[model samples]
Target: MTSIKIDRSACQGYGNCVLALASVFDVDGEGLVVLRRDTVEPGELDGLRRAAYDCPTDSITFVA
Candidate 1:
């Protein structure tokens, strides 16, 4: 199992994370990143990595 973390302060509202995985990431009204879901299942690892990799600000990280 895995979990995700978001550093809102580091988020630039690029929405790349959302684009990579909308089921786990969202954009708030303030244009900050929000978590739709934090837990990452084994099958979701690829999408998780994509979201983390796509984040230019590196606001999202995963813990296993």
Candidate 2:
């Protein structure tokens, strides 16, 4: 499984992560990005990486 981490302090609530990986990331009512799953399936890793790369703040980290 792949693990994902997000630095809340660095996050800008831009929703880019959510848009890129809706199954793994979600935007709360306040527009903050939230991790829906800690462990990602192998098939989802590509989307997760895309989301992490899309983050303008570069707050997302992946641990494989």
Candidate 3:
């Protein structure tokens, strides 16, 4: 199993991560990025990677 991490302070609410992996990322009412879950399924890595790559602020990260 893999783990996901986010830097809330560095997040800019661009929503790129949510667009890439909505199951794992979401936008709060404050327009900040929030993690729906921290653990990543093996099949979800591609989406997770995509979300991380799409994050303009580099707020999304993972440990595999």
Q: Pick the candidate with the highest lDDT.
A: 3
Error of 1 at 40 (Å): 1.2
Off by over 4 Å in 3: none
Regions of candidate 2 where Cα sits further than 4 Å from its true position? none
lDDT of 2 at 54: 94
lDDT of 1 by residue, 1-64 (tens): 8999999999999999889888889999999999988897898899989999989999998997
Q: Rate the local accuracy (lDDT) of all candidates.
A: 0.92, 0.88, 0.93
Clashes of each: 0, 0, 0
Q: Report the lDDT tens digits of candidate 2 across residue range 19-39.
A: 888998987787777888887
Evaluated against the true structure, the overall lDDT of model 3 is: 0.93
Better of 1 and 3 by TM-score: 3
- Residues 27-47, candidate 3, lDDT per residue (tens digit)? 999899999999889999999
Error of 3 at 14 (Å): 0.4
> Residue 48 CA error for candidate 3 (Å)?
0.3
